[model samples]
Target chain A: MELQGIYILWLRDLKRYIRARSRIIGSLGMPIFFLAFFGMGFRRVEIPSLPQNITYIDFLAPGIVSMVVLFTSTFSGISIVWDRQFGFLREIMVAPISRTTISLGRNLGGATTALIQGLIMIALSFLIGFKPSINGLLFAFVFMFLIAVAFTGIGIAISTFMHDIHGFQIVINFFVFPIFLLSGALFPISELPKFVATLALFDPLTYGVDGMRWAMIGYSEFNPLYDLAALLIFCVTIVFVSAALFSKMEVE
Target chain B: MEPIVVKNLTKTFNGFKAVDSINFTVKKGEIFGLLGPNGAGKTTTIKMLVTLLKPSSGEAKVAGYDVVKQPNMVRKNIGIVFQEPTLDLELTAKENLDFHARLYGLNKKRREERIKEVLKLVDLYDKANLQVKKFSGGMQRRLEIARGLLHFPKVLFLDEPTLGLDAQTRRKIWDYIIEMKEREDVTIILTTHYIEEADKLCDRVAIIDKGKIIALDDPENLKKMVGEDVVSLTVNDPERLIDELALEEIRKIVRIEDRLELSVVKGEIMIPRMVEIAQKVGVEVKSVSLRKPTLEDVFIHLTGREIREESGKNAFWRR
Candidate 1:
């Protein structure tokens, strides 16, 4: 029963995104472009103490994939706002489904979109000279899924509190952007200011990026096990928080 | 049995009561109307009873379930058409209905069948495959009604369902709604600012204004409360006539539209006296007409204001 609901919602989400070709391009195209630019820009640049076999672009591919997932999942919150403004949200709210089911369905839908975009980015990364083994690809997919779910929960949680489209956009800019920038998606946490680096440790996206990057290139500042564990814990926390908030939200 | 009941139901917003201890009941399969102006509490009361908003202090029940405690159950049995157009503009009318069917947990085959039935009922079967953005405003409203009926809900709540539709389309939907109520034995509670809509469609109506219900009864009985008929005389000076009529033995003088409207047990007898008095005082009588008092008259008599007075006049096509 749960799986069916999840599949239904996931399909609905994908259908909406696919119907709008521009949305698909912006979500999937942006990440691939960033990956290509970075991969080409540092293909031959040698670092002072880096291993001979490691290339900067190859090291950066996994982080870009993780970033793709993050962006897609976070923006998925806008659907919730749109649904409210458009009256679809009320239709769902008045349905007999449990509030938890609603949260789960929406989160899973968003996670699926993020995962699909992440895979597309990974496929493009291969074309741009970043290569990973079969096992590495599998691990990256799993890590991307986890990150997607986590970010989706964060998106849902934010969605419940927004009353208007403008308010929702403001929240995305205030919270999502900060979380994305500080998650070490484009740069290492060690490269940030000490206080910012300290704050990054608590951000859920940090674990997703670090874990996916470690899976791709086997290089990360944090242990892969720790990162995965933190992400799971964060995902659970976000889902529960979102479910509770959604249940408390009135449909007016 | 009462399918729904409200006892002292009140909802306050920002320290102002939107629904002020309003009380009413609806029996099974009955059509109930909540008639009020733009800022009146009709919508708030419906929202509270539908469990969309918690009442400030009072309580209500819907479908034998307490709106506050068994909200989910109440939601399960009731469908709603909000004032605003809520259709997913990007989806075809059929897909929109299909999505609603799935949400209600209908099986795939049953979902498709129900969608088809409702599409036909709303006269939208031919346009089902067309995206909602391509639909006319009337078509979109019909699609919304179709969506609301997909689950065979026991009750349907329509908040201003015909607010912005053309008169012809509005009447067509009213006919469809009445047919649905009869054919399916579904109880329908409708809230509307249109006085004629409430008069023509509702079996019982509660006149609400400024958060309180001023009168509740069958439309005929409520209209009778105003008296046999009303005499409206648009005089050059309304205040002078008000003072002049204040002294006369007129039954009740209600001022509306810069005119003096009086409800008399025998308005035909009182018309000539009023005209003579208007002439004596040099009050230029623009015109005089007498007709049976309508729900609008009842609203003014009870609330001391016209039903649609406070709100901006809605151009026929603007709504």
Candidate 2:
């Protein structure tokens, strides 16, 4: 019974993601544009902090993939606000299932879509002459999924407290940009000043991007094991917190 | 045990008492109504009974399960159609029902069968594959009603089921509600400000005002309390006509602007006598009409105010 509730919620999200053809296409435009402009525009530039013979495209590819996951997963929380506004959330809240199951189902559903978006980013990177080792693709997949799960949990957690969709857009934009920028998705955090590097250490996406970089291009500042552990902790904590908050949510 | 039982259930928002302590019960397979104008706590009481909101004091049970202590059990036994549209517009009608069925833990065969049965019951089977966004307002409401009954719950709570629909559509929805009650054999609790809706669809109604139930009885009996019939006459010099036409058959007479409303037994029999008395007193009778006492008259008699005065403004706010 519990599993069925989770599966149903997940399926609903998947169906919605598929049915909104314009949204799926529109959401991909920004990440791909970033990949092309940043990769080609800075292809000739070099930094002495780089490790060995990795090209700019190879370095920017994994970051772009992580960015796709981060943006899609965090933005998925807006659906909860929409559900609240449109009255669909009450239908789920009034159901007999536990809120933990409901939250888990929604988190997993958002993560799955985010994972798909990341995978599509990876595929699209190949068109721009980006390359990664064949054996490391599996590890890259794992890091990408962890990134998706962690941020989707963040999105759901934020959405449970928000009642207005327009207000949520303003708030999530404020959070998403800072987290993405500070996580070194656009540049190397090692080149930053002492205080900024320390701040980067606090961002969960720093580990996620570092892990993906190590998997996709064999270049990373932090240890892959440390990155994996941080993401796992973030995923578990956010999932539990969102579930607790959702259980206490009231509908009028 | 009854399908629903309440003992002094109440809810307060901050210092404001939205739903004061009130008690009522609903029998098995009965169509009970909570009738009131806006801000009268009808929605609040329904929310508490459906386990959506916890009461501030007292207790209530739905389908034999305590609402506060056993919310999951209460939720499992009851179905609700909220006042607003709750359907997922992106999903097809079938997909929406399928999602609901899965959440309720219905298996493959039963889900398919019940989905077909309910869609057909609400006359939406032909549009089952279409996305709900494409449906008109009346069709969407019908689909919601169909979805609410998909689980065949022991109790169904419909909050303003026919609200905001045209008169023809409202009547059609009423027919479906009545038909579903008989065919499904489930207890129904509906809230509405529409007097005709309560009178036509409910087996009994609890008329609420300002967080309290002012009256509770079958429509016929409640209207009977006002009088058997009411004779409304617009005559020249209504004050003099009132003084001259004092009869034992006329139970009460109240004068509004340019009209005298007489509460009487057998209003048809009293109308001719009233006209004759007005003629004898040299008072020219401009208009005379005889009709049975409606629930509106009862509401006015008890509250000393028209329900429509408050409801008309509230209806605009709802949109």
Which model scores highest in lDDT?
A: 2
What TM-score does model 2 achieve against the real structure? 0.94
Candidate 1 chain B lDDT trough over 10 residues, lowest sum: B310-319
Off by over 4 Å in 1: A1-7, A167-174, A188-196, B246-249, B265-272, B312-319
Residues A230-251, model 1: lDDT tens digits: 9888888888998898888777
Instruction: List where candidate 2 sits over 4 angstroms from the true fold.
Output: B233-248, B253-261, B268-288, B312-319
DockQ for candidate 2, please give it: 0.82
lDDT of 1 by residue, B1-319 (tens): 6888899988878999888887888978888999988889888888887888888898888888999999888988888888777777877898888777777778888988888898888899999899888998888888888888888888899988898787899899898888888777589999988888999999999898888888899999999888898888998788888887764456788776678778887778888988898889999999999999889889888877887765435534543
Q: Tens digits of per-residue lDDT for model 2 on B164-254?
A: 7878999999999999998996999999989999999999999999899999999999998888888889987989998987899887777
Clashing pairs in 2: none
Docking class of 2: high
In order, what is each prediction's RMSD in angstroms?
Answer: 2.6, 2.4
